[model samples]
Target: MDSASVYTRCQDRLLDLAAELTAEQLATPVPALPDWTVLQTYAHLAGVCADVVGGLVPPSDDTTTARQVAERAGDDLDAVCAEWRSQAPALLEVFARETRARYRLPALDVWHHENDIRGALGLGAQTLDADQLAHFTVGGLARGWAPDVPGVRVVAVDTGQEWLLGERADLELRAEAFELARAVTGRRSVRQIAAMDWKGDPSAVAHRLPTLPAPEVDLAV
Candidate 1:
């Protein structure tokens, strides 16, 4: 599926899942985001869509994010889902037209958050469009985190897909694309990253792994 379709379908799936959840389930704490509950997470997602639709840039600052959550504090899953669905179509058009990675961020963000919500709800990983999107997400994260010099050569064993970031291919990493997507996005701990197949010392290139430090404990999804 295309990027727009991928994001649209993911949003639809999330809304469908929300429809099945009770208030208690919606209040479930997301392990990835300890400070936010499932409903809070949905609120943030909807807030982002609102920002994007309104032609405002999404900020990662704590104050802005906290405000986003606070604005929808009283909202339930149904309300938040409706808000997101309303703003999604406009963003979907942007996704379909923009070729730059910047425009692709929403698709990646929504997919990543969908899995986060799924995990907190005790749902298994959704594999529908995972394989198609995993490569892009993993490669983007790798490139974004990698240094200007030669750093890592990531090889997706499942699909034989390869992404050589930086100027040269020095450190080789072998793993499934989906796992690499999770790992590079701070879903895996540093210790877990070290456990993956590596041709060179993972610690040598640890600085290029993630923008923030990986989780201390394994976050099984």
Candidate 2:
């Protein structure tokens, strides 16, 4: 689906969005990601692009990554935004050259963070390609995203896409394409996801999801 091109388009919009924000506004805390301000979030988005383009994610742990992003985050919002703008083309170029399956996480990372900025600023829903999202949702599930809920049959009613994950084939989740992608991307609240149509044990799968109001203890262990 040319995820790099999709990511570039989405990223250009985000950079434009950042250009509109004031320094004071950039410092304001984001509701969607309380631990980071808009500036830090912007830095993080840049950091991810830099890591991907440079292949320099040392330690390969969330804590280390967070520390690097936090350390690099600055009050110069325009410069940070500009940095991302400059670096993105190369990242997108790499993405374009790589295999489709290689984009599983980068596509999700950029897409989720774009929505993160959009959601925090109350910009409302951004344009999301259903087919792309559906592809990622299916891929994420197959990659053991929700391990406890083996046997999930997902159908996006909008695009009429289907994916059978796991061997059990007992539970089914029916939702719009974007919701399904957001659910798997660690964006949706637990309550919001549990409310979706389910043919089997909801709690079993719901608890397994990487969700919001995040767990207090880091379960990286």
Candidate 3:
């Protein structure tokens, strides 16, 4: 499906999942993110969905994004979900007319947090949207998350998709497409990212990976 479809479906899914959860589950610690609970992640995501339609992306960074979540991360679970639901429609409407470039951030954010909530609740995962994730990882490495050193050649074992970042590439990383995407998006910790097969200095490359917040637990690889 397209990015907008992905965003809308994900939002609906999270809302449904949140509704099924108790207040305690909503507050469950997500080791995948630093000092954040499921409610906080949802609040952060809902905040961004609301912010995008209001014509404010607030510069894609940890500090700013955290502030957005903090602003709306009220104590009441139902109230927090309501806050998110209220703004989801406008974000979906905007995504319908715009390209992936417009919705990519929120789309990926939602997916990343989907796994985060699941992981936190000890809910087993089956698979992810590999097609979208593959492309998102490429864009992340190329633009928003580019490493400063020589490019590392990333090879997705399942899809056989490959991409290079930086100059004279000496590093090689191989893993499931979804795993790499998770690591790049900060859903997985440095340890989990390093768990993937590599030929070069994985530590060096790991340091450069994007930081949504380093997960406390080992994420699926």
Candidate 4:
């Protein structure tokens, strides 16, 4: 898939969403990332793009991401969104020129964060491309990182897609395409995963995910 295009589409929608928020909405805390307000989340998104365009790796570490958010602490929602837009062109160029799988990660991050922002604002799910999500989950995340689960058969009930994520299929995790992606990407807590449709034990792979661990608290979204 054209990851750069996906990134652009998701970014545009997110920015549009930001444009409609009230000051109170911007300051509202994201349940997915409780420590960050809606505006702070945008700051990180923009910061990641800036770092990439500037030839620096985007900050995945807490210290660096915190610094990114801190640097934009004074920026209002409009300014923060503008900063994110400013980096879009250059970042798109960077992503378009790449053949490596890591380039798709930014698109995935934006997609995930867009949903997080929406959920925080009490909005329903955005009509995003589930196919892109499926692509990212099957390639960039599950296959790319290769989690240490004994075996995982991920069945996306909403999309009718399935992926075997380990050496063998010993466990089946069935959920909506978005939920599956969210679960593996740290948006969902262990309790949330348990609440999903699972064959065998969810615990077998709940914590062994390759990306961020599941948060302890079940996010309201």
Judged by TM-score, which candidate is best? 4
What's the lDDT for all of these models?
A: 0.77, 0.68, 0.73, 0.78
The digit string of per-residue lDDT tens for model 3 on 111-141 reads: 7778778888988662557657766766567
lDDT digits (tens) for residues 1-221 of candidate 4: 67777788888898778778898998899988878999999999998888888876643678878988999999988888888898899998988777676666778788888888988888887646766676576545556535554677888887888888777888888888777777777878887877788889777666664367677778655
Residue 201 shift from truth in candidate 3, angstroms? 4.0
* Superposed Cα RMSD, model 4: 2.2
Output the lDDT of residue 197, model 3.
Answer: 89
Give per-model TM-scores: 0.88, 0.82, 0.82, 0.89
Which residue runs does candidate 1 get wrong by more than 4 Å?
58-60, 141-150
| Candidate 4 Cα deviation (angstroms), residue 158 | 2.2
RMSD of 2: 4.5
Superior candidate under lDDT, 1 versus 2:
1
**Any runs in candidate 3 off by more than 4 Å, and if so which?**
58-67, 73-75, 98-103, 143-148, 167-169, 211-217
Measured with C-alpha atoms, the lDDT of residue 198 in candidate 3 is 85
Per-residue alpha-carbon lDDT of model 2 for 139-167, expressed as tens digits?
66666654445677888888888887776
Candidate 2 achieves a global lDDT of 0.68
